[model samples]
Target: MPNGPTRYDTVLLGSPVWNVLRPPMIMSTFTEALDFRGKTVIPITTRAMSGLGTAERDYTASCPGATLAEGLAVRGEEVSKAEAEVQTWLKRIGLPPR
Candidate 1:
């Protein structure tokens, strides 16, 4: 069996965009299998250029009633330098910096 589950108010879902628009098929499968209702769902993306792509729409559809928070999209090569940006995003979403 897996470890004990922890409760949370927010979720960060991440994926690398495929073909400059869509997230990988695995993302769709993963999201569809989860229950995100009433939570703050935020999408994180590692991209070459196309921003958050269709993550916002995809999550909105898959996670019914979830509060869609601002998503974070970082350059694929710049993930290591995204700490500050991520912190800011968390704050903006009413979460304390971790």
Candidate 2:
């Protein structure tokens, strides 16, 4: 957490382009393992049809106090087409559209 006013109350946990392009590259960030104290830290990923994969379980175990939810697992190739769906999902989850 930073000292000043935070830009996000909901942290969209996502991997970089390189990670998305690679396979079997499941990894976590520093904040992924912290106790978020019930704050929303939504995980979003681009996968090859395998929905949610192991991320939900992994995140739940890592961030004990955070309200981890079922993440979006859109196919990598369909990302552009799925933008609106993703934005809607985010909004439904209380996050602002990008």
- Give the candidate number with the greatest lDDT: 1
Tens-place lDDT per residue, model 2, 1-98, is: 54211454556667533433432344455554344656566777778756666666666665666777656877778888998888888778776688
TM-score of 1: 0.86
- For model 2, the run of ten residues with the poorest summed lDDT: 16-25
Estimated TM-score per prediction?
A: 0.86, 0.69
lDDT of 2 at 13: 69
lDDT: worst 10-residue window of model 1 = 1-10
Q: Model 1 off-target regions past 4 Å?
A: 1-6
lDDT of candidate 1?
0.84
Best by TM-score: 1
Superposition error at 29 for model 1 (Å): 0.8
